[model samples]
Target: MSRLKLAICVLDDIQPLRRVGSMANDALVLLFMIAIVLVVMAVTLIGGFYLVKYLVERTFNS
Candidate 1:
């Protein structure tokens, strides 16, 4: 029906704005979580690197 088509057209405009806002919110949350994971991984990598280096040096020197 033409009325149904008109109704859908009206809803389509509003739908995108709502979807954009929700997508932005989701993206922000995902980035924040990713940053936290990266920080943790970086710290662990740094600590492990130093540990491996220390052990290798000690072994070779001794």
Candidate 2:
């Protein structure tokens, strides 16, 4: 019974380290997803801007 209690105590002490590691992984994945979304948005905006500019120039020049 004493050895079982000691083992439980040791496991409890390690739990927080496991939780911290899990949180770090979650945060890393979140940052990667955000970066991908931002890149896609930037490309879309730039493409739209150039398309509009081209259309305006073509209409006015003709």
Candidate 3:
């Protein structure tokens, strides 16, 4: 019984460390997701700009 109580106390002490690791992982995942979103948005904007330029040039040349 004393061993079991000691084991539980040790686990309780370690729980906060595990939570800190989990929070760090969550923060990394969030940053990665934000980067992906920004990249996608930038690509879309650049593509749209080129598409518009191409159409305008074609209209004026034809």
Candidate 4:
């Protein structure tokens, strides 16, 4: 039937768009993971710096 052929063609045309949407979703997930890792690293570095400063001050002052 001509109508069935037309529907199949439309579905084929839209399949690439669906694939692109999934790819974008994957990229966003990866970006968020990288951001989280960077944030954690920054927090630990800052905390360690302050902790060392505290220990050094305590050792020399006392």
CA lDDT, every model vs. true structure: 0.99, 1.00, 1.00, 1.00
The list of candidate 3 runs beyond 4 A from truth reads none
Q: Compared with the true structure, what per-residue lDDT tens digits does model 2 show for residues 1-62?
A: 99999999999999999999999999999999999999999999999999999999999999
Q: What's model 2's lDDT at 46?
A: 100
Residue-by-residue lDDT tens digits, candidate 3, 1-62: 99999999999999999999999999999999999999999999999999999999999999
TM-score of 4: 0.93
Error of 3 at 32 (Å): 0.8
lDDT of 4 at 33: 100
Cα displacement (Å) at residue 51, model 2:
0.9
The alpha-carbon lDDT assigned to residue 30 of candidate 1 equals 100
Can you tell me which runs of candidate 1 are displaced by over 4 Å?
Answer: 1-16
Give the alpha carbon lDDT tens digit for every residue of 2-43 in model 1.
999999999998999999999999999999999999999999
Give residue 24's error in model 3 in angstroms: 1.0
Off by over 4 Å in 2: none
